[model samples]
Structures are given as structure tokens and as C-alpha cells.
Target: MIEGPYFVLVVLGALWCGVAAGVFVAFSTLVMRGLGALPAARGIAAMNSINVAAMTPAFMVVFMGAALLCAVIAVVTFVLWPEPGTVELLVGCVLYLAGSFGVTVVANIPRNDALAKLAGDEDSERSAAYWRRYLSEWTLWNHVRGGAALAASAAFVLSLT
Candidate 1:
């Protein structure tokens, strides 16, 4: 018989992955903006970076990695994609992963590193200047990353119909 539970799993996994990705983008935007709001905010952003660094390695290694593993297993479980449902689910999952990696690797980490270094030091012209630079640059990329996540989620939901 065609697999039903596995089929449901794919759809649901895509749904949840999409949701989690949207949340990540939102929170990152909030963090970026919060950091931008004040001269003293660099320390907050650095703390947030430590939060991000703590979170990302584990997420990249475990949760997102597990989702990828699930998608790979789904492909192998049925000789062909069991349904259009599966193809859409897999594509949504890929978009979520790629978009997420783009944010974390491309945008956040470098900003985090810069924030960490500057926040680690005292208030100074260079440190203040560095934070100002991050405020402008980081916020722009966060929006792009957030949009990618929103698109991924919308596609995942459409796949359910």
C-alpha cells in the first residue's frame, strides 16, 4: 500500500519547518532592531550573539540536520515521490534550510562577531562607529532573510492544498 503516515509526516514536517523559519526571521529582526536603538546596545547584541552562537551550532547539527535527514529518508522510502505532497514538502524544507543558513552564516554571524568585539571593549569612537555601521547593514539583510522565510512558509502551506 502507499505509505500514509510517512506522507503525513512529510506534509507536517514541511509545515512546522516553515513556521520555525518564520519565527527565526522575526526574532532576528527584533534583535537587530533592538541593537540599533541605542548607543549602549552593542552589549545587548553581543549577548544576543552569544545566544545565537549557542543556538545555531546545535540547531545546524541537530534539528535542521534532522529535518534534512527526514527529507532524505522520505525520498528513499518511496521509489518515487509518493505524491505531489512529498515534492512540495521537500522543496519547502530545502528553501527553509537554505534561507536559514543564509541568514545565520551570511548576515548574523559577521554582525555578531563585530558586535562581540566592540561590546567587549569600552565606549570609544571606533566602537561607536562600528556599531553604527552594523545597525544600518544588519537590518537590511535581516529583512531579506525574513522575506525568504515567509515565502518558504507560504509555499509549504500551499503544498497542503
Candidate 2:
């Protein structure tokens, strides 16, 4: 059975993944929907505000810390090959690193960066068009990341058992 600092890390990783999953799920299920219901300009403005708020130290520590932990776990898992829960631990690492963290870097952040460039003027056709597409695309990616984090958390829990 896994023990010592390694075991503690895994437990923490599981909790972190669960927290990340909950945040993503909130955006996918409720936050985005509520924002989308607003006028296009208002929705864009609100999302921009949310995006800025998300960068605060509290959220970043959890989100980025989870990614860092996953990377460390993956490397350690490789070095300590054939240990108990190896497969499950590796699965959790990959799910969070690639599916959640990687997707955020590749898919969501770019879109957010683009959205940030917009003036969010109510009369601007360009902003309105982008906002419509952003609502659907961003939320779709959010759903994927949320599922991945939840699955990672489950995998980590399985490793403990």
C-alpha cells in the first residue's frame, strides 16, 4: 500500500482535483448560463470581469497547484514503477495534466484572451458575434475539463483503496 509523504500527496491531489472539478462544473452548469442570458454586451463584460477575478491568488493556487502536483505525481509514479496503485495514480495524473490543465492552456485561455480584447460595446457587431460563439465554445470546453478533473479525482480515490 502507498504510504508516507507520497500517500499524503495523493490524498491532497485528489482533493485539489475535486475542487477544480467543482469550479469548472459551476461555470459550465450555472455561471455561463446566467451570463449568457444577459444582453450580449453585458454578458461579455461580466465574463471579462469573471475572467479577471479567476486569476486571483486563491483560485490560481488551487488550479495551478493541482497541475504542478499532477506533474510531480506522474514523474514519481514512473520512477517508482510497479508500486501499488501505479496505474490508478498514473491515470489520475494524465487526466488532470492533459485533459484539465492542457485543455485550459490550449483551448480556453486563447479564447479568453481574445474575448478580453473586445470593447464589449453594445452597438459593436464584432463584439456581439464573438460573444455568441464564446458562450457556446467556452462552456463546451469547460464541461470537458470539469469531467476530466472529476474523473481524475475518482482515479486518485481508487488508488487509495
Candidate 3:
């Protein structure tokens, strides 16, 4: 049961990601809907900043930790998974790490980079343009995040196996 302390990490990482997935789905959806109503970059910028600030710490921890943890889980599973629904849980874990987390780090982070450049001081065309473009593109990624998270959540359920 202890050859792989990694599985413990994997389960920890999975639960961590699972929580993040839930938060991402809800928050990103709000950002998406916010796009239609927020005509200013300031509003969008505020939302983005707050969200990033709130998310960065946990995301950094889990993103760095997941691979090591999951790999251990894979090894442990290969040797000693309980054999009921282990496969489902493992696959679900893979999907979240591969799909949802991938989208957040790859797709969303870059957009946040772009968004961070926009200034919120007074009315400005560049800011508006940035907000408009940012909202549209960001929302697409948000949907992807939400979908992937839902899939991951389903995978988390497999832990019962």
C-alpha cells in the first residue's frame, strides 16, 4: 500500500483539481456572460485580475504537483489498483490533467496575459478593443474549461471504484 506515496499525491492533486474545475466553470461562465454586459475594459479587467489573483496560488501548486502524483498513481494502479472502477478514475484523472488543465494553462493564461495589458483608466479605444476581443476569445476558452471540468468531475466519481 506504500510503494507509491504518489497515489496519495494523485488523489490529493485530483481533489485539488476537482475543486478548481468547479470554480473555473462557475467563474468563467460568469465572465462569459459578463462580456455581453460589460462595455468597458475596466470591468473586464477587474474581473480578470480578481479571478487570477484568487486562482494563481492553488493552480500553481496543483499544476506543478499533478504529474508527479498521477504518475505515482499510474504505477500504483498498474501494480495494485483495487480493480473495480480504478480504470475509470484513472482515465478521468487523465482527461482532467490533459484536457481541462491543459486548456487553462495553455489557452486561458495567454488571454490573461493579453488582458493584463489593457488599462482601466478612463475611456479609451484601445482598452475597449482589448476588452471586446478579450471577452469573446476568453469566453470560448471558458466554455472549454467548463466542459472539460464537467468531464473531470465525472472522472472524480470513479474514485469510488
Candidate 4:
């Protein structure tokens, strides 16, 4: 069984993953919905502002820190434990790294970037069209990210038990 500092790391990592998951959940549950209900250009503008504002140091410390911790947990678990014991940790690690972090980098960030470049005009038909696409596409990927985070959190916790 995991003990000492490694155990603490595992728990902290899971907690961070859980926190990250909660942020995504909030976005999926209400934030996006609220934005979507606004006029398209307004919605898009709001989202662009949110995307820009979300890059604060506090958010990155949790988001990227969770990814880092997951990597560390996977490596340490693999080295310290046998097959079955390490399995969940590795699974959690992969989900966080590839599913959560990768999707954010590969899919969501690009979408946010594209949205940022859009002109913020409430009456612009083009803005409306872009908002339609962004709302659907971005939210879909966010669900993936949130689900992966929750699953990774569960996996890490399971590994400890």
C-alpha cells in the first residue's frame, strides 16, 4: 500500500484533479448555458473575455499542477508497486494527461484562440455564426475534459484503497 510522502502526493493530486473537474462542471452546468442564452455576439464576447481572464496564475497552478502531479503519481506508483496496484494510478494518469490536459491543449485552447480573434459585434451575423459553432464544439470538448478529470480523480482514489 502507498504510504509516506508518496501517499500524500497521491491524495493531493487527486484533490487537485477533483478541483479541476469542479471548474469544468461549473462551466458545463451553468456558465456556458448563461453565455449561450445571451445574444450571439454578446455571448461570444463574454466567452472571449472569460477565456482571456481564465489564464490567471491561480488557475494554471491547479490545472497544470494537477497534470504534473498525475505524471509524478504514475511514475512513482509504477516504480514502487506491482502490476495491479499500479494499474489504477497509471489509468488515472493517462486520463488526466491525455483526456483532460491533452484536450485542453489540443482542442479547447485552439477554439478559445479562434474565439478571441472574432470581432465582438452584437449585430454581426458572422459573429453569430461563430458563436453557434464555438458553443457547441467547445462545450462538447469540455464535457470530455470534466468527465476525464472526475474519472481520474476516482481512479486515483481507488488506487489508494
Model 2 regions lying over 4 Å from their true place = 120-122
- Candidate 4, lDDT over the whole model: 0.89
* Pick by TM-score: 2 or 4, better one: 2
Per-residue accuracy of model 2 over 1-96 as CA lDDT, tens digit each:
788999988999999999999999988999999999998899888888999999899999989999999998888889888998989999999999
* Candidate 4 per-residue C-alpha lDDT over 55-161 given as tens digits, one digit per residue, 9 for 90 to 100: 89999998999999998888898787784547888889999999999999999999898887785464678778888898899999999999999999999899888
What is the TM-score of each predicted model, taking all chains together? 0.67, 0.96, 0.69, 0.95
Model 1 regions more than 4 Å off = 1-3, 40-79
Model 1's alpha-carbon lDDT is 0.59
The number of clashing residue pairs in model 3 is 0
Measured by TM-score, the strongest candidate is 2
Q: Scored by Cα lDDT, where does model 3 land?
A: 0.64
Better of 1 and 4 by lDDT: 4
lDDT scores in order = 0.59, 0.92, 0.64, 0.89
- Would you list the clashing residue pairs of candidate 1? none
| Predicted candidate 1 versus true structure: per-residue lDDT over 1-161, tens digit per residue | 22466546555555555555565566566765665665655545555565567677755553365356445644644455665555655565566556655566778778777677665563777777776776677666656656655565566556567
